[model samples]
Target: MGLLVVAALAGACGYTASARYQPSGATPSSGAAHDPTTDPASATAVALSVAAGAATETYRTDIGNATAAFVADIGTLQEAVDGGDIGAAKSDELAAQAQYDTFRQLEGGNAVNASTLDELATEVAPNGSFAGLHAVERDLWTSGNARADVAGLSVQAPVAQYLLSRDRLTPEAIGTTAVSELGWVVSTALPGREERFSHLDAVDIAAAVGAADQAFAAIEPVGRTVDPDLTTSVAQVFSSLEADVGSLGPPTQVPDAAIPTTLRLSVSQQVDATAAELAQLAARLAPLGTAGAPSS
Candidate 1:
C-alpha cells in the first residue's frame, strides 16, 4: 500500500495522538487561571476513542475473512465425509490446520488486542480445529437412526464453550484500556514510533476488538456477574468483531453439531455489528489533533 493508505489504515488500527494538554500551576477558583489549552483528561479520551475505533474495524475485517475461509473448508470436508471419501476429508482437514497456523501467527502474543481475537477465530474455524470433527459428524450422519443426534456434536460443544469464554469481556473495559495505552504510549514512547498511529488499518482494528471480545467471553459464569447494561455493551462489542470478520467473506461454519445453532448465529451477528461500529469509531477518532475537542 502507498504511504497514505498505510497511514489511514494505521490510524484505524491504533495510532496515538500527541498530547494536547500540559500541566499548569494555576488553580481555577483561586486567583490563578486554569489553562484550557492543555486538558489531559480530554486529550486522553480523544486518543482512546480513536484507538478503540480503529481496533474494532481491524478485528471485524480479519474475522470475516477467516470465518469465510473456515466455512468453505468445512463444506468441503462435509461433502467428502458424506460421500465416504476419508482421504479427501483428511486433506481438507489438513488445509484447515494450515490456515489455523497462519491465524495463530496473526494473533502474536497480545492477548488484549483485537489481533488475538482474530487469531482465535481463525484457529477455531471449521477448517481449522474443526476439520477432524467432520469424521465424527460423518459417523453420526451415516449411522442408523438411534436418536435425533446431530453430527459433530461432541467436538462443537467444546469449541462453543471456548468461544463463550472469549466473548466475556466488557467492550467498555477493552476500549478504555486500548485508548489509555495509546495515550500513554504517545506521551512516553519514542517519537519515531508515534508516527505509526497514522498507519493503522482495518485488520489491526479487528484484531484489537477480537481480543477484547475474547476476554469478555472468557469470564466464568459462576462467579462472574454481568449487569444488563454491561451485557448489552459487550454484546455490541461482540457484534463489531463478527461484523469485521464478515466483511472479509461469508459466515464460517462449525464442524461439530454439538455447537448450538443459536449461539453461532448470535456470534455471527455480533461480529457484523461490531465491524460497522468500529469503522465509525475509527473515523471519528482519527481526525483529532493532540488535544482539539472532547468526544461526546
Candidate 2:
C-alpha cells in the first residue's frame, strides 16, 4: 500500500534495505562432507523452516507496514479531489504516485490487487487499461476539460490490494512473484510507457526492483546456504540493477541522455542476466524457478 515507513524512500532515489545475512550450516561447495544419507523428510523440513521464518518475520512486516502508509496516501488523494482544487489535487496525486510506485511493485506480477484496482480505476476514470494511479494522473497532467477533479471515491480496491496477502504468503510464492514482476520490468515496463499518463516509468522501474530486493532479502540466507557463489552473484547483479535504475533520476523528469528511455538497453540485459541467476536459485529452493524465465 505504501513504503515500509514514512521515514525513508526505498524507490524514489533507489534506496535499499540493509541486507540481513545468516550463517549457512553446511558448506557444500567447498567439497565439505555431505550429511550421511540425507533424508527426504529432513530436507523438506529445512526448506519449510526457512520459508516460514522468512515469510512470517521479514516479508510480512515489510508489506504490512507499507500497506498502512499507502492507505493513508489514498485518503490524501481522495480528499484533494473532493475539494475541487486541481493544484492541490496535482500535488497529492504526485505524492500518491510516489507511494503507489512501490505499492504496485510489492504485489509482484499480475496480483489480485493489481487486477482489481484496474477495474476500479476504469469504473471511476476515462477509457484506458490502467485505472488506478494513471487514471487519477490523467486529470492532473492533461489540459483543458480532460483535467478535472476525478478519482475513485472509494479506497476499497487499494486497501485490498495491499492487505489480503497476510494470511498465507509463503516466501517461495513471494520470491516467484518478485521474479515475475522483474521480468516484466526488463521486457516491457522499462522500455515501454509503464506509467504513460504520469511519465513515471523510471519511478515504477526503481520501485519494481526495490520490491524484488525485498522479496529476495527474505530468501537470501537460504540462497547463500544452498549456493554461496550463486547468492553472491545475485547480490552483485541486483546492486548493478539498482544503480542503473537509480541513476535515471526521479519520475517527474526525463531520464539522462545515456538512458533516454526509462532504462538503457544494457540495463535491460543486466536484468535478463539477473533473472537467469534467480531462476537457478529458485530451482534449488523450490518450484518457483519458472517465474524467472520470460513468459512464452
Best by TM-score: 2
What lDDT would candidate 1 get against the real structure? 0.36
TM-score of each: 0.28, 0.68
Deviation (Å) of 257 in candidate 1: 34
- The clash count of every prediction, one per candidate, is 60, 1
Tens digits of per-residue lDDT, candidate 2, 1-296, equal 22232222212222122233221232233453653112323444345344435543566566665565666766776776766676776666655554554445445455545653433343443544444556666656674222222345244545554354433334444566667767877765676455555565666567677877777787787566656787788899988988887777665565323356434776788778777777666655542111121112
**Candidate 1, which segments miss by more than 4 Å at Cα?**
1-45, 99-150, 153-296
Cα lDDT computed for each candidate against the true fold: 0.36, 0.55
Question: What's the distance in Å from true for residue 43, model 1?
Answer: 4.3
